[model samples]
Target: MEKTSGWRGTREIWIEAAYQALIESGIDAVKVMPLAERLGLSRTSFYGHFSDRDDLLKALVTLWQSKNTGNLIRQTEAYAETITEALLNVFDLWLLPDLFDSRLEFAVRNWAHTDQDLARMLEDADQVRVEALQAMFFRFGYDPDYARVRADTVYLTQIGYISMIKDRPSEPPGPRLQRMPFYVEVFSGRPVSDAEWARFRARHPVAS
Candidate 1:
């Protein structure tokens, strides 16, 4: 039986260290020794859970997929009365960091610039997320082509925000929340009903 190191951090502790390094300094900073040092553990402790650096990297990717893409897909499936309400459900991702980690998303996209495999994974995630949005539009009676276009519009717009917000200081949600009704009208091609806006505001009271 393999002897476990006493006082060494668990797998989650190591992965969280790697996650923070990646978010703060990009992928190159996610080295095992550095992470071990940061955790005040011996380098060998990392091998207890992950075979090597590659294994840890894969775990990070899995975490990103599960947290970011998974939440976005789930939000798209949330119950809503109108297309406007449905879109607002998805928009919760932007306001709720617990739902989606924009810094991690941006970091992974940056990492993908040099990693073909990660690029492919990122592409797959984008396709899956867009498809979820398309399905939501379909539920609201949008035709196929229109749904596709609108889905791309909504997905790309959020992605654009993610990219633009990278490296910038965090901003208040009020500005964006104030403009949400207009965004809903434009994205859904219909006015946001007062009830829908009220519900959305109640769901996100920080901006109120």
Candidate 2:
């Protein structure tokens, strides 16, 4: 175990250790003693930050809410000239790990299967995300009902893709990314112009 010399770590350190544990080995592995060990801190140090394991778990959920759901909504609201660009903005979450943590998302969703409260929160998050997408489409002058359906299609398809690939090794960006323009076209019923594609591609040079 790597040890930190003379370091008792901070609240964020403990929470981040807990977060990694939760994502890597599920909630069952996010215990104070183990986290302290992982951080090279004493078990007592964890209590200085969190009251108990439950408190740490709550903090983890809050982190997820802020990082994943919050960023998704923000992406939908990001400035874009055309609906295709708007959809591409949201797609940034999938391509950019900093924008959205898919592993953390998958971990929390699996954890939710056994926790009723978390399951409800996950449902609320899904609704909030879909509504954000709907609003994005609406801003581009799509009819309300059609916007909702398109939003559902966009959100559900991404969720399904996440679920399907959760356990697989990360693939090269080129294969999947090549399909994104087609996906944007399908989602927004608009073709991506060369300029728009170039802008999006520049943001993700790995796909070039």
Candidate 3:
């Protein structure tokens, strides 16, 4: 393990730099020496934050899970009174950048193609996210097998969306957001009221 002396700064600075590098270039560009140079500090400062490059990579995965999967699960539990509401709450992950990062997710997913360890980590994270979504469905009275399928459907759809959209998500939210209620109906085997639809539109207010 590497050691450092008197490095006084938050680990976020390094992680942010790594995140940028990962997004801009690829995982190989997220090196301690390069990051240290970018930050105008010695590589020793990295040891203050992470033990090595593998540690930094692990941190990046953790950050992605915490910000994307964790945030979506929190929103699902927080906003969903009904199955329709639950689906829209989860849809926010694709519709809004504030709730998740499509580019970063794409970057990590692409990286995973080359690294078995990263692939495993991502697979595990996927399971956790699906389970969390399943819990949300179960709370609304779905059976375990039914909820599991619904949860996988929602999670995989979002992942597919991220995979397809290569550029910064410039797609207008209005048209797509309009279809969310329909998607909810399909996924949950439930109907959405006009009032519920109106309320959802009011909350999002996507332009046509």
Model 2: how far residue 107 lies from native, Å: 0.4
Best by lDDT: 1
What is the Å distance of residue 149 in model 3 from its true position? 2.0
Write model 1 residue lDDT over 152-190, tens digit each, in one string: 999999899899886578778898798988987889899
Candidate 1 to native Cα RMSD, angstroms: 3.1
Q: Could you tell me the lDDT of residue 44 within candidate 2?
A: 74
lDDT of 2 by residue, 108-204 (tens): 9999998999999999999999999999999999999999999999999988878867567877888778889999989888899989888988888
Question: How many residue pairs clash in all the candidates, one count each?
Answer: 0, 0, 0
Cand. 3 Cα-lDDT: 0.83
Kindly indicate the candidate among 1 and 3 with the higher lDDT.
1
Q: State each model's CA lDDT, in order.
A: 0.91, 0.90, 0.83
Candidates in descending TM-score order: 2, 1, 3
